[model samples]
Target: MQRRRLLQSAALALCPAACEKKRRSPLPFATLADLTSMIQAEQTTPLLLVEHFLERIAQIDRSGPRVNSILELNPEAKTIATTCKPGLLHGLPVLIKDNIETADAMQTTAGSLALRGHKPKRDAALVTRLREAGAVILGKTNLSEWANIRSPNSTSGWSARGGLTRNPHRLTHSASGSSSGSAAAVAAGLAPAAIGTETNGSIVSPASACGIVGFKPTVGLINGAGIIPITHHQDTAGPLTLTVRDAELLMQVLAENFTATPLPDILIGARLGVLRTQSGKHPQVLALFEATLQKLRDAGTIIVDLVELPNAREAGALAWKALLIELRADLNAYLEQRGGDVRSLAELIAFNEQHRDTEMPHFGQEFFAQAEQLGTPEIIAAGQEARKLAMQLAGPEGIDAALKAHDLDALICPTNDPVGLIDLKSGDTNERVASTPAAVAGYPHLTVPMGFVDGLPVGFSFIGTANDDAHILALGHHFEQLTQARRAPAFSAG
Candidate 1:
């Protein structure tokens, strides 16, 4: 027995390299760039990548940790992979947020039961762009119902159709919203990356909470034709990825009038301003911010402290008012064109009331009801004016003014507070987040994992003026390289 045990131990010791060949290809937490390289080098085929991810979705997303990030997987993904030609994305499998329409076997319900089985006749412009770039549509991810516009008191990751998407880092924590599933899936290594939309903090907040990179580009930069609407002024889809470089690559494929610009190789002498007002009230987050600032300083960055945006409070309030007013009109338009039985905001409200047991069990649709009440033509005109003023305040007088005044390239702040507890009774308890100014202004916002606090992740943000997507991405890439702070989630049962 002793001789047999010794022989077995020796065999196990020699099996690492041999056994590794039989293990999963591409490894866990592989970035999109890494996958692209593997595909280009013929190290892995597209079908293999799809199969591997499908298996992971079964193991990690569905069963093991039960992150429940995906709403539906593409039944045709493997076949699509086998036929996909070499291009920018080149057989990569990418997940789409449910709000974005894809004309496929999978449904795009935006997490609302009313829109169940609602598949579009044509792909959303961004989905078309992904297809053109040789990406296989892997699946649709769950989201906050109606992109969290259904209720002012809604729990962010909970949907009547998809249930709740838990944070991969800690099961008890909130995944933020409405891009919760997209962010969680990327952080959990279910896919190389996922696409998410942001009306306010939908992309960045969830990305920060899940410890990944989320980039919200200028609103109109990517075509917004087929996405379910909140407000056209504030709504845009962006990439959530494990690295800023992957975000950049996805943006290159998604953006219209694509232009490639050379980015700086290093962060030395890079000038940045700190947005103190939007920085959260969490002490630990603030400490992490300070430590990150010192790291930047040590890396030869010029940090300008405490730059305040003018009329930030007023801008946010006006933006909210505008969103409420626009919601009814924009959503009505989308619903009508979408050719669904629930074809209007009023009808949608009624649909929810009829299905209250499923849809309204946890929270009421106060925002939708409020928006339905404000359907007067006069209110819509007022909303347009408010949108104009908000853009001026948050864009020219806000982010741009601060940058020009300080002669800085961009603004930096904490992306969000640490992950809050998942509370269905009280709904989301998110504190101050740095996504507002950029979100309202339709500028570029990039969040990269900064560090952890008490086993939860926080992100450092880079906010820049309109059409400054490339510069913001470059800045975030530099910070990511310098700090290397992003760690894969352990799926702890906290």
Candidate 2:
């Protein structure tokens, strides 16, 4: 087994006195294990943790940087934490994305104004499972309205209910999306960890841009019964935290049967496919990626370089078509059960039009209009075919094919370019993102902090086949141990 290496860097060691104190405090930016140990040793109670987080949310999130990551907090969080039964996550606080149902005093608006007062009669299955695991539902984080499916040119992290979520690294940069708030909140030390759902790049991208750990488990590994839909084919909630082990703990709780055994030597003799095609255009990103490649080589891992996925553009088009159709059908189903003020996609569109002053001030609902028009049987059939083709292309013909051909245990690529400038006037400025293949294939993808560029952080992704969630987590954990790539956000405020 390869011995662990510590990254003894000046930046890491030169933490401010306040940060050092925070790191040692009752509610530090800590790992799940650290918190659990404190609780187990009777050093702190779950109620104390909840109150600490709630106070931090009030100080940093609502007043200081005005990160705007949270939409609402559960008033009964302390009560729930106090009376919770012991389980894996006992007494932990996890922030749920605004898109997920909580069935509490909070509303599951999915960041849409139309669902401002919508409340489900029952909690989402995942929420119920989390509660059973002793997790205190901390509150809801803001997100891109309708999970950023409302328009092609919409700004990420900008929901009508929750204005804009600023990156803690730099107040003006984008937090990515549609899991924007979840990632931002975690990065800003507003929560120990948060749950973020992804359809394509939603989870990993934000986690990547925000400089944290994001794990998108094999689709269907975690129950998606309560999450607001983007595409049932690609939606799954995962954890965003300071460390990969925290993500593993969360995955265990979320995927009830999950238990991770340490891989004695995760890197020795392992073969990893380097998806060069998906690396971003940014020069700094390329440099960081190359440095990462060198680290892997030094660790005795074989790198199969310059690999490409076939039919990339065509598969993307198909995925888009499928998303529209699935959004229409899946959303309608969710609304039927949700019994919201707006019952259908058509009503949602009309509502946006009616509230153009607030909702449409930034971008129009073009994607929603398309979804409204995509209800015909012919369109539905075409969408199903497209989804199948996209899945085949992204799965067997794409990621799976290359993995088999190269004898790779996992795949690596830049998760996204460095954080972009948040521009509401022209909408989100996206860069090269490596999420589509695993997303459409319904596989597991994990993004870990890689390095920084121009003071902003970027991440590298480790992707594996459908049931390889544990393997990916092990790889990420090993890599993190070797590099210690994650840097605490500066919380640069306006």
Candidate 3:
């Protein structure tokens, strides 16, 4: 009660979330891998480069600077960064979401105050891959508290411990979440590239709002051995990057599932499904999508008119239901077996009760309490039906059905409506259509910077079925290779 009361006092300033577009944080227009080259060419050392980023954080993050995406910096970064070796992206700096673990100094809390001091014993599989590939782990960025599982109606990017991350594009605008800080960090040049995982819009939504490239590969493409739990059925890590090439570069180095292969000029004879229903997005976003589509058509790409999936809505509904059930079951397993300093979900609720002073300051623990009681057979049985319904509706029934009908190699849609204004008292307006279907179905989805709206960026997405991942990536790469629409934001005074 004490924690809640104190937190509620400042809730207006950072209530359900902080106000968006706080300031115009224009970014240095650049690519991620290019920074690696500049570092290697003796133009800068990894230490100096990392320091420059740290300086940027000092200037704009939520603390002194108040951009507010980063939770903690790795103290050993400067010491470890000086030792760069041979690899595709040797010495590139990476910012990871707090949910992903690293055997480093920083604590992985998924931005929840519950485990603020808890530390993982070792690196998650992807982190290990990044280290092996010669990339430096910069630090952990914030997320929608607990990857946005705390509540169905929870605000994006509002964590009690980390606060809310603002978008670099327009400060008062929503940066999107659960990968909020990761995307904002990339857009703000706090780090060259960052890893963001998604069950639904966790990765892609933020990447879209931050006006960067976000990629969610086919499930199982990347191993998930040591990350925080969500729906195991659809969760996967991806790149929220500045360019398609940069996103792809990160993927090549990270995915142990593949041996690195040089990509040729991707084929132009691809058939793409233009999701007309997705056109009702913000006019500015639609304008950019049309331009990109016209460019692809002019370049000899086959554009197909694909109708809406008959069961897409049902699939979306089921995906949300399954996530709630899986979150309870998966989080319980992780919290119980992980043997961390933090207690179980039920205990967490009690801790929040005991320390409601800090935990429930901004929002209540309704979801946590619900999860605890949901272990009953009624909830389990209902959850199972939802899961089954989702698989049939989203999978072979919907997207696949459309793909087969159109002979589509990929489907193109606006990543989301332009980033909305960040509001504190109320949570997100939550109006945006995402590529979440692809995410929920465990398919491959890629968002490339298509154009800017209000001087801020939004991306165009390409989604494809599992095993057909290569085709979609190729299509995205081809468009990205041609239309380089991405530009870093300019840090403007509010």
Sort by lDDT, best first.
Answer: 1, 2, 3
Model 1 lDDT tens row, 75-185: 999779878766899899999999999998999899998987666889999999999899999999999999999887889999999999999999999999999999999
Q: What is the C-alpha lDDT of each candidate?
A: 0.90, 0.87, 0.77
TM-scores, one per candidate: 0.95, 0.94, 0.89
Q: How many clashing residue pairs appear in each of the predictions shown? A: 0, 0, 28
Model 2 misplaced stretches (Cα beyond 4 Å): 1-24
Worst 10 residues of 2 by lDDT: 1-10
Model 2 scores a C-alpha lDDT of 0.87
Error of 3 at 57 (Å): 2.2
RMSD value for candidate 2: 7.6
Error of 2 at 268 (Å): 1.1
The digit string of per-residue lDDT tens for model 2 on 1-494 reads 01211231342377556434543467558677888888897666786788788888989889977888998999899788778879989998899999888888998888878887768787888899889999999999999888888898999999998889989888889999999999999998888999999998899989988999999998899998888898889999889999999999888888856778699778888899888777767888999888988998999989989877666667788998899999999988888778867888888888889999988898999988888899999999999999999988888888888888888999899898876788999998877678888898899999999999888889989999888999999999999998898877887753
Where is model 3 poorest over a 10-residue stretch in terms of lDDT?
18-27
TM-score of 2: 0.94
Q: Which prediction has the highest lDDT against the true structure? A: 1
